[model samples]
Target: MKRITLPLTDEQISTLKAGDSVLLSGTMITGRDAAHKRLFELIQNGEKLPVDIKDETIYYVGPAPAKPGYAVGPAGPTSSYRMDKYAPALLDMGLKGMVGKGRRSDEVIDAIVRNHAVYFCAIGGAAALIAKSIKKTEPICYEDLGTESVRRYYVEDFPCIVAIDCEGNNIYMSASDISAPI
Candidate 1:
């Protein structure tokens, strides 16, 4: 139950594993379905993106609007699989981590392993609770994309479980499959 924060580098990320607790800071871009589609198309057509993927963490969250005195609204991890199709390409470009809920494709897992990346899952159904961890947020591009638009967040000890690791380890499956006491 230790805490680790970011601007973490490859060596730091490569060393992480499932079950590790993390508090990520720095720039993590938000992208769900629509944004992912646009990013994929851009990559395919060799178009430039607003931000580089190198050693970046992609959070699978589309937060609600911020209320007064808040930098962002209720923000929490969304389903991970929705972004699966576009994940491999991002990982190939040096995406080192992701934040979301549930499982992902084997291809995505393989991409994580092959590219030395990891996936973290936040507590689902806890948007309000999670929002408190976010110190601030702002849009980067694709503003018309709504909350799915790329943005940056400054978080303070945002909690998460490292569900997948660079070596292909995953925690969610094991957690779900644990036998109940008879």
Candidate 2:
């Protein structure tokens, strides 16, 4: 497994390849559809975003409320396609990486390549297991969105697979390219 530091540098991102298993450490922000829409709108209106995304990673998640002695609860990736509409803009804004589950749109994949970004896939249904990696969770913006609110998480050895590398090689596409009939 490759160990990656967060806010990935250009060299680090370039070195990653689709299908690489990675253990990431450092700060990653969480956001799902609601938060993405709000951020997209803000960008559309030429307003400053609540957080600077340059060199930062955004995890597409909406975690359950923490139980006692936990940093977060049931933290898992949401479907990446739902955020595809807004992802390009975020990439354009210097967002370096994204973490989520499932396939992404062609446009979104293209944007990732153009922006020199990487897309990771967190295991679905591994929520409780994943939360153990989180060391800190703090609200950052859009508190009214409740569970969908944006938050910053400090993580240690958070597990992921490189679903789409900076060069635009996509694991999902490889799966789709399989010609054998099941």
Candidate 3:
């Protein structure tokens, strides 16, 4: 597995390829459709965005409330396609990577290529395991949205795989055409 630090440099991001396993470490922000919609609307209305997305990675998730003694609750990726409409605009604003599950729309894939960004797929149904990688979690904005609020998470060795590389090669597309290794 390749190890990558967050707030990735262009060189670091360019080196990754679709289907490669990655152990990601550093600060990542979490959001879902609600948060993305709000951010996009803020931009459209000529208002300041709540957080700077430039060269940053956004995870598509709506985590459950944290339990006592825990930094975050079961945090898992939501369907990436749900954010497809908002992704291109965010990508245009310098968002560099996305973490989620499922295939993205053509528009999002186009934006990924145009913006030199990447899309990662975290293992679905592993929310509890995923939460273990989070060292810290604090709400950043949209608190009224509760679980859908945008939050910043400090993570370590968070596992994921490159689903779509910057060049638009999608692992998910190829995976279906090939047999699983025995």
Candidate 4:
């Protein structure tokens, strides 16, 4: 397993490979489908996004409200394919990484390769456990959207697997290939 800090550089991203387990620490922003749509529309109209995503990682999670003593509650990764429509454009704009669950679209994979970015898969069915890694959370924008709002998260030892790497290797496809009988 590897340990990575947030706002990964090109050198750091290049070192990742699909199927590698990693523990992430530091800051990452959160956004889900609704927020992504807004950002996409802004980009389409040539308007500036409220939050700058350059060289940052966006986690696809709509975190639950914080419990009495916790930063967040049952914070699990959302399905990444839901944001496929907007990911390529974001990646083109210097967005360096993404964290979520499941496979990504081919277009997203192409974008990752084109931009030298990486995609990580958080464990499904482990939302409560995942929340333990988040040390702090603050709303950034789209508050009206409730939990779907974009937020900044300060995390430590957040576990994930490299689902797709800068070289365009995809663990989803690799897993499928391995399971397919000859």
lDDT of 2 by residue, 1-182 (tens): 99999879999998999999999999999899999999999999999999888889999998888888877889999999999999999999999999999999999999999999999999998999999999998989999999999899999999999999999998885465788887
Model 3: per-residue lDDT, tens digit, 1-182?
Answer: 99999987789889999999999999999999899999989978989998989999999999887899998999989999989989999999999989999999889999999999999999988999999999998878999999899889999999999999999999876455768885
Q: Whole-model Cα lDDT per candidate?
A: 0.83, 0.94, 0.92, 0.94
Q: Write the per-residue lDDT of candidate 1 for residues 91-150, one digit (tens) a residue.
A: 888888888999989999999989988899999889999889888777778889888888
Per-residue lDDT, model 1, residue 59, is 81
Give the local distance difference test score of model 1.
0.83
Q: Rate residue 48 of model 3 by lDDT.
A: 91
Candidate 2's displacement at residue 43, Å, is 0.8
* TM-score of decoy 1: 0.91
Mark the 10 consecutive residues where model 4 has the least summed lDDT.
Answer: 173-182
lDDT of 4 by residue, 32-124 (tens): 899999999999999999999999999999877787988898899999999999999999999999999998888999999999999999998
Candidate number that wins on TM-score, 2 or 3: 2
Q: Which stretches of candidate 2 lie over 4 Å from their true place?
A: 174-182
